[model samples]
Target chain A: MATATVILLDGLAYGMVLFIISVGLTVTMGLMRVVNLAHGGFAMAGGYLAAMMIRAGVPFFAAAALATLAAGILGGIAEMTVFRPLYRKGELAQVLMTFGLTFVFIAALTWLFGTDVKILPIPSYLAGPVDLGFRTYPTYRLFLIVVGLLLFLLVWFVIEGSLYGARLRAAVDNPRMARAVGIDVNRLFTITFVIGCALAGFGGVIGAEMLQLDPFYALRYLVLFLVVVAVGGLGSFKGSFVAAITLGVVETAGKFLFTDIAAFLLFALVFVLLLWRPNGLLPPKSVA
Target chain B: MNPAWHALPWLLAIAFYFTAGGYLSLGTSILVYILLTLSLDLALGYAGIITLGHAAFFGFGAYGAALFAIHVNADPLLGLVVATAVTAVFAVVTGMLILHTQGVTLLMLTLAIAVLLAEAANRAYKVTGGDDGLQFTMGPVLGLFRFDLWGQTAYLYTLVILFVWFVIAWKVVHSPFGRSLDGIRQSQARMRAIGTPVWWRLIAIYAISAAMAGSAGALSAQTTRFVGLNTLGLLVSGIAVVMLVLGGTRRLYGAFLGAAVYVVVQDFAAKVNPFYWMFVIGGLLMATVLFLEGGLMEVLDIGRRWLRRLLRGSDPT
Candidate 1:
């Protein structure tokens, strides 16, 4: 019973982090039809920036916020400049270019901060244990759950309830028709891409403890993020939410139960699931 | 135009032997990289198999050779044959399972194979030496020319093997089967409509490419006497892609130029700072994809055309 509870809470926290990091990749892939392999680079950028700021005497939360915003700005600039040309290119070019960008990001990070791992220290309030009615838990885990749920709701409201959400959905379903119906799909992509980048950055700063922050952070955790996106289906936000949770629980369970073969099992599961549903569990109507 | 030009690279290798006092091993590794890239071109450039996990076979080849040396026989030739055979068989089985899937799924599956193999190797530490890497000494080639302290035998041995593979690759690219592969690359459906067994053909080429890659891996292990876990890493596969792309895919000699340039640049870049290599390679990759689509080969072709026109003093129609 104790193990179950621990696994559940930890898995939920991990799932939230995965969702926050990978949702952007799914969105950008769906929107641009380009495999942006450098998406993790933005996440790493945010983590490194936050680490730098925190080390320079800024409060942790403020540093995280600033870093998230900076990541968004960086993403926007990248989308406008480097990513713009990719829209018309083939998959080969897209993969090659984005993968190249990842190397550059790693190089820059290494040049700036050396290759040592950096950690983001949580405040005392968040670091301490909190008493649940049934059991005691770390305050940080609970905080992650709350923050993740709130962010989910906010994203849900934006993507489902708002008029902008309708337009975005239309664009995702069928971009040509969406444009024919007077929706500015390009601008929609930019807005959504920026928001997605910010979310990844936010995830980076918060999830750094579990994922770790180093020069190779971008490429190191790439497989995990890509798996989340793949399992969740490329274009579905709610799908990513569910997939992240499931993968988190399965991974956490595997870690405790089958220590050596956990990664192998997870990758094998991806292959099986893909074979079962090539389009993913929850695919959009007309995936480009 | 001149058949004599074919021997130029071999000539350079023979000259490099005496002149390059301390860099023979570097030359040997360059030959290995060249072989790896050439194998990748056969699949990626010719057959349109977009894989990111070619390093898996390379790693398998290395492990197979290393283990064979340690346990079975220390004969280099026997180990090479065993390693290549095992890698090709593995590729055959994997290709059967994965060649049906196209696009994103195919890409992910290929990557998964490499990751799973790496993980498996990491866990079986006793055999693989885990992250510490596997080290083994082997008998000299045919018990004749021993691996010398100066690495002269290793360089010559690798060069001869590279030349053999290069000839094979050249012949394979110009053959009927290679043309069929080109058709499949252009349109798998069209090839299928014409009674071509698309999946089986892919499997065949994949096995051949794997065999070549495995041979390179075996060569690396035999020459260096060590196999690092990084032989199976995504970085190695990514570097192969960069090298092949840089040299120009579809052009047989691209691997030679790409490997040489990449190694030279990497040597210089690493001297400045360890991280500078990444920036240089990354910048070169982007530039190649965006501007120099045909890679340095296109530039060379244009130069050749200009030179011919200049000498002839007229349009060379």
Candidate 2:
């Protein structure tokens, strides 16, 4: 019973991080119609940057902030350069180009980083454990839960309440009409991509302690990340939130329960979900 | 000018080059790769099926051949035949279910299928030898000729197989059935409207291509005497697509040209600087995508057309 509780919390914590990272991907794919294989690259860059800064004696929060900013910059540049050209092309070109960029990023990073698994230490402030009546959970893990909730609410408020969010909503619904209404569609797209990358960067900082800072980790975890996005559906925030948490818990618990069959089962779920919904669990079909 | 007299000297020179250069093994590998690339051309270039899991069929063939050889002690010819048959069956089953999805969905599904098979191979330690990979001591060829490590015998075998496959592929490409495939490529909706069974045709093409890929794999395993997980890895599948694109899609000889360029560049570049080969490949792809709109074949065609014009200078009809 205690083991079950522990697994549930652990899964939730992991799932929250996946949620944060994949929400950005879901949004970009929803608005831009580009399958950014380099989305994981942004997470990687942020994790690496945060690790380097932490090793250099910078505070974790400050390092994380800088990493998020760096990711946003990289995302903006990718939008302007690689993605802009493929907007008018087919989905195959978009997938291929992004895949090409992914290889380039992996090769370049491997060349620089020497393939070793780089570690990030858990910050002192968030170190130790909290006693729950039956079991003790890591304090840092609890902190991530709190942080994750805050981020969820913040994103929800901004997306539902703010003017920029309204413009974004308009763009997601109909780009032509949004442009006709004098919204700078390109600028919104750039901002959205940057914001999505920045969220992935934040997820990286919190999630880095769990995942090793390695070159191929991005490729290794890419399918799962995509699974979260696809199961949640594009442009549907609520769907991503629910799907991400569900997948995180299921996958984490699956490894424990199913053992060797975890990966197959996880992928099978993705296939089944896609088959059922064609687009996703909850496609953005209302406004459009 | 007598035709026999004109071609006889060139044929003798070609024979001399093939004999002197020990070009058999290298030439055969090129031919096998040409077949693999042609199979990819049908799916990627013609059908717009952006598959990144093509190595699934290749690995399937390798394993299939090994299974046949180990259990039945089958002849090498029979091994390849069985391998192709198995791969075609697998392709049909998977392609029918997966090919209905378009774009990233299809890519992801294909990738998942490849990863599933690869992981299964990894976990089944006793059967596949797990991470160490599978090994087979191939029996005599066609129950007659013995296996030779020397380049000459191996090269001729592969070259002949390639030539035969090329002839068949050329016939298929030029036929009315192939033209129907072109129509499907342009628009599935229009083809469906015209009463073309788009889905079944796609499944058929995918199965045929998988069979060809499987043959390449069987031949490769037989010649090399070893097969690794990397044969089914993303890198091989990615490179095959890259080669096809570099050579230009929908062009017959383009697959051969692409494979030659890809293999030669990898071999040469690794010798020169192993670390920078990927950078070179990426740069080349970018250049091709940005500048060579129609791929390397288009550039060559333009050059040839220019040369012809220059040779026929001032001649007006």
Most lDDT-accurate candidate: 1
TM-score of each: 0.96, 0.91
DockQ (Cα-based) for each candidate: 0.71, 0.43
Candidate 2, lDDT over the whole model: 0.78
Which candidate's TM-score is highest? 1
Model 2 C-alpha lDDT per residue in residues A94-167, reported as the tens digit of each score: 66567667767777877887678878788887898889998898988778777877888888898889999899
lDDT by residue (B1-317, candidate 1, tens digit) is 45766777779878988999988899999999999999999999899898888999999999999999999999998999999999999999999988987766677778888988898899899989999998889898988988888899999988988899999988998999999999999999999999999999999999999999999999999999999899999888888888998999898778888888999899999999999999998999889888988888888778878887798886565
Name model 2 segments beyond 4 Å from true: A286-288, B1-29, B314-317
lDDT of 2 by residue, B1-317 (tens): 23453344235424743684665566667767888998888777777777888899988998888878877875788888899999999999999898887766677778778877877777677888878887878877767677776655555556666666767777777788788889988898999999999898889889988998898888887777777777777676877887887788888567876887877777677677654666567667656655665678888778878877987896765
lDDT (tens digit, per residue) of candidate 1 on A190-255: 988998898899999999878999989999988888777776777888877887888887888789
Model 1 spans with C-alpha error above 4 angstroms: B1-5, B314-317
